[model samples]
Target: MAAAAGPATLPAVVEELLSEMAAAVRDGAPISDEHLLSLKFVFGSSAIQALDLADRQSITLISSPSGRCIYQVLGSSGKTYMCLASCHYCSCPAFAFSVLQTGDNLLCKHLLAVYLSQAMRTCQQLSVSDKQLTDMLLIERTQEA
Candidate 1:
């Protein structure tokens, strides 16, 4: 999405999350309500880390042998989210810069999708990382790796 104006400044609160959803539509994903609810949120997060914005591009359930505990977000809308497990971040272009330059977290649309996509952890656990959140929101891909 470079060479384009950055994602609109969407405050991370639950109410403004739709702006990021709208951003995804602009970005070309055309998120459906079914896609939106895929995040499988049990208790609402105060601020959406990833799934609240864009669907986790790709998901690998890293922590789950049964594939239930942990999931990883690989990419979205053909954009690969290279989320390094170390720094707690996603390689999504949106997180490269912060619009406000003040918040501890830059709420990008990809992060929003982490909570909105369908392929989620059916089991419950504690806190999850941003990339893991991305995994939670990913739609299952038919193509094999």
Candidate 2:
């Protein structure tokens, strides 16, 4: 981090890194050592998926039969996270449970927290916005794709 940079810069940098990681994991390759190192440096491996995004969020990491990555976001808060997998389904109990028991609308605080954290790290126009992060996600996504 540069002395001139603000406290928010770090998370923006980390988001760029995570976007790259997301693109990588989406591509069906095993996560590389360099990526693990980045997570360690950025999030300090404090939580389970902190090392692996899906894990820290308690997402059940799975892949479609065709090999597309799938996530079962098992948030204890009873809400689900987003899914970018081919089918793109989230598995929070609130989603399924309510859908089953009653036709109720749903959005989750857990997902909000996770998304904000991720967005801060990845989405530059977000609260923790940074140009470097925005460019990096697209760059990594394109390069990997």
Candidate 3:
């Protein structure tokens, strides 16, 4: 019988595959079936939905003049949450549990969406005032209606 992969193996494999996919996309090459299958298997259904939303321009990423990469994801609930790519963090519960606490590198949908958007070179920007940033953070914690 074949031995199972070690803990570090999976992340490394996923990283390599994602990099290959990104490179193929940048080169305008048709992505291979193996790459697509690897992506689907690694990221699962939620990430696919996030990618679709990103393709539809539902995810908005903001880049400050200071070189900060912040993202805003509009969820199906009609609410927006922030994503910090530099920190590998998001203002959503899925990120908290799936990425942070569990230490899973897979990341939340918002993060995945931002990644796909950046890889495809279709990321957009939105201007948010400092006050809005504060409000957004507050709302993320409280989830106010």
List the RMSD of every prediction in angstroms.
Answer: 14.3, 16.3, 6.8
Query: On a 0 to 1 TM-score scale, where does candidate 3 land against the true structure?
Result: 0.72
Best by lDDT: 3
**Model 2: which residue pairs collide?**
15-121, 15-122, 49-55, 49-56, 124-129, 124-130
lDDT of 3 at 13: 74
Query: Tens-digit lDDT track for model 1 on 4-73?
Result: 6553443345434455555676566765665345323422341244452222234443443333344345
User: What is the lDDT of every predicted structure here?
Assistant: 0.42, 0.42, 0.72
Steric collisions counted per model: 22, 6, 0
TM-score of each candidate structure, all chains considered together: 0.31, 0.33, 0.72
Model 1 quality (TM-score): 0.31
lDDT of 3 by residue, 45-142 (tens): 86677767678777777654454446888865676778877656778778878777897647787877777777666677777666666666677777
Give candidate 2's whole-model lDDT: 0.42
Span of 10 residues, lowest total lDDT, candidate 2? 119-128
For model 1, the superposed segments whose C-alpha errors exceed 4 Å read: 1-57, 64-71, 74-77, 82-88, 99-106, 118-145
| lDDT of candidate 1 at residue 139, scale 0 to 100 | 35
